[model samples]
Target: MDSGIEIKVMNPRRGDNLVHPVGVGHATSASSAPLSSTSSPLPDERGLRQQQQQEQGLRQGQQRQGLIDFKPLKKWVPWIVPGFVLANIVVFVITMFINDCPKNSVSCVAGFLGRFSFQPLKENPLLGPSSSTLETMGALEVSKVVHRHQAWRLISCIWLHAGVFHILANMLSLVFIGIGLEQEFGFVRIGLVYLIAGFGGSLMSSLFIQTGISVGASGALFGLLGSMLSELITNWTIYANKLAALLTLILIIVINLAMGILPHVDNFAHIGGFLSGFLLGFVFLIRPQFGYVSEKHVPPGYIAASRKPKHKPYQYVLWVISLILLIVGYTVGLVLLLRGVNLNDHCSWCHYMSCIPTSLWSCKSQQAYCESIQYGNQLNLTCISNGKSNIYTLSGERPSQAQQLCSNLCG
Candidate 1:
C-alpha cells in the first residue's frame, strides 16, 4: 500500500451514489419529480380562499364598529353646539316670520321675542320683566324669576331672550363657540356644556337678581365664549395666534351683554353666564384630552362610559324627567280647565299671538283645549258647540251624526 496515496471507492449503499443504468447496481433516481397537480391549490382556488378570508376579517371589523355607531358622542360635542346655535338662528327666523319684520323692532320683534324677559324691576306689573310663556289655548307658560342662586333657572333662562337683538347676539356667540368646541369635543361635550353652562348662568343670574324675569340663551352662549377663551388661555399652543378670533368673539359678546347691562342690560345674566362658562370651561375643557382628545375626550378610566349608546342611564333620567314634566304639565292643564279657565282668559296663549283667524275651527274651546289634548293630529277636531264640548268629523258631516256615532259606541 502506498502511504502517500489512498484509493477512494463509491459506497453502493448510498442512494445518491448508485451505479450506471446498465450496471447491475441500483440506478440513481432522478431528482424528485414535480408534484402532479398536488403541490398547492390552483390560482383561482387560492384567490377565492384569500378573498373569503378577507371578507371574514372585514365582517369582523364591521361587527366591532357596529351600525350607526353612537359611540362617538363625545367627538360630536362641537356638532351639537353648532346645531344648538342653528336652532337659535332658526328661532330668530321663526320670530321674523311671525312678526313679519316690523319697521320698529320694539313692536313686532319685541312682542314675540321679548314678551317675557327680565327687565329692570318697576312698580308697574306691565313694565317689569316677565316669564317666557308658551301660549296653549288659555294657558300661559309665563317666565318665572328666581333669586339667590336659583340654579335651576340656568337651564331655563337660556330660552328667555328679551328681544330679537338679544336672541341674535346670543345665537351668534353660540355659533362661534359651539362650532369650534363641538368639532373638537364632540356632540356630548357640546350638548352638556351648553346645557350645564346655560343652567349655571341662569342660576347665577337668578341668584343675583331674583325679582326680574331674565331670559335668553345668551347666558349660555356667554358661557360657551368664556369656555373658548379659557381653552385658548390654557392651551395657548393651539390658539397662539387665535387673537383675532378671540377678540372678534369677545367683542360680539361684549356688545350684546353691554347692551343688556350698560343701560337696560341684564348684567346679572351676562356676568352669571360668563362666570359659569369660565368655570365649566375649566372643569370640562381642562384635564388635557387623552392623546389630544383621543377621538372624543374619553377620560382615562371612563372612556367606556363615554362611548355608551344615547339611551343610557342619563337618557333614562331624561325620560323620567320628561315623564314627570309631562305628567305635571298635563295635570296642571286639567286643573286649569276644571277651574273654568276659558280661551279668552289667556289671550297671549289661546291663539298664535292672538287667535287663529281660520274659520275651520268652529269652537273656540277646541282651540283652547288644543294644548291639553293628547296625540293631537291634523284631522282630530274637538270644539265647542252651544257652550258644550263638540267633536268635529273629518267627513264634514252634521253634528247630529257624530252624536249618534258616539252614542252607538258608548252604548
Candidate 2:
C-alpha cells in the first residue's frame, strides 16, 4: 500500500478558478503537514479548542470576580443634625410660652432679655419675666449653680436661647457645620462631642460669669468648628488641597470667635467649647483614612507586622498629644470649677470688659444712671443728651409729671 497526497497552487494572473498540482507527497502524517499562514499548527483540533475555551473561561471568571469584589460605599444621612435643630426649636418655643413672648417687636427682644436677667439692670417688668423665672427654669446662673447646687443648668442652658435672633444664629451654624460632621462621623460621635462641648462651655461660664443667666448653643457650635480643625489636621494627607481647606476653616473659627468680643457675648464659653472639641476630635473623630485598621477588615495576626497602618507616623503622634492635652485641660477646668476659684479674684475684667464705651450703647453709663437714683425714691424727669432725648417716669406717674419735672430741672 502507498500513501500520498497531492498539493495544488493557484495563479491569480489567469483569473480562472483552476488549480495546478505543485507536488506529490509520500508517507506524510497530519502532524507533519504544512500549515497556511492563516491556519494554526496544532495537530489536535479538540485540544486547541479546549485550550482556547479554558483561556476564555479564565478571562470571564476574572471579570466575574472583579464584579464580586466591588462594593458600593455606604451613604450617610444626617438625621442627628436635624434632630438637634428640632430640639433647639422646641425648647425655644417652650421658652416663648414661659416668657409670654410677643409676636414681633422690641418688646419681644426685651422680654427674652428680661427673662434671663440676674441683676436689676437686666430686669424689665413690662417686657418679660424676672431673674426668678429664669432660675425656676434651667438658666445657668453662677450663684444658683454654686450655692443652690443646680448643676443641671449646665446641660439645660445649651438648649435655651434669649430670643429669636439668638436661636436663629446658633441653629444656622449648627445646621451648616453639624450636618456635614454628622454625615461623616455618624450620630453618636457628633452628639457626644456636642454635649461634652456644651457642658465644657457651661462649666467655664459658671466659673467666670458671676452675674447674668447664660444660655444658648454657641459653645456647642464652636466645638464643631474646633473638631473640624482637628479633623482637617489628622486627615491632612488625604486632602487634595489641604492648605486652602485649613485656611478656610481657620478663618471661619477666627471670625466666629471675634464676634464674641462684642458686648454681652460669652467669649469664655466659646473658647472652652472650642478647646474641648479640638481635643476630643483626636480621641473620637479619627477616620480610618488617618491610619488605624478599618472597621471593615480584621487583622490575621495580633503582631505589629501583621497590622498594617495606613496613616503616617506623625498622625499617630498628634493623636497621642491631643489625648494628653484634652486630659490635662479637663483636669484643670474641673479643679478650678470644683474649688470655686473666683476668676474675678485673679483677673477682675476676665468675664467682661471694664467699659466697652460704645457711642451707641454703654452698660456702664446705664448702670451709673440706675445707681444715681436712690432706692425707693420716686423720680420723673427728662433730659437731652448725646443728640437724643431721654425720658423717665415712675410706673404709676403720668407723662405730664415727667415733663413738669424736666422743665423744673432744665429751667
Candidate maximizing lDDT: 2
Report the C-alpha lDDT of model 1 over 63-147, residue by residue, as the tens digit.
5444223233333434566667666556545433432222211122134434333222221122222121211111112232211
lDDT of 2 by residue, 1-411 (tens): 233453232222355433332246453432444423443333344565687799999786666544433323345788988999999888766655564423211123434444332112223322233333455569888777777777788899898876556778889989999988888888999998999889888887777766777888988888888989998888775567889889998998888887776766787889889988998787777754522444344334322212446666777888899888877877887677666777768986675532243677554422111112323435533344322233343444232333333332443
Q: What are the TM-scores, per candidate, against the unseen true structure?
A: 0.39, 0.66
lDDT on C-alpha atoms for all candidate structures = 0.45, 0.65
- Model 1 poorest 10 in a row by lDDT: 132-141
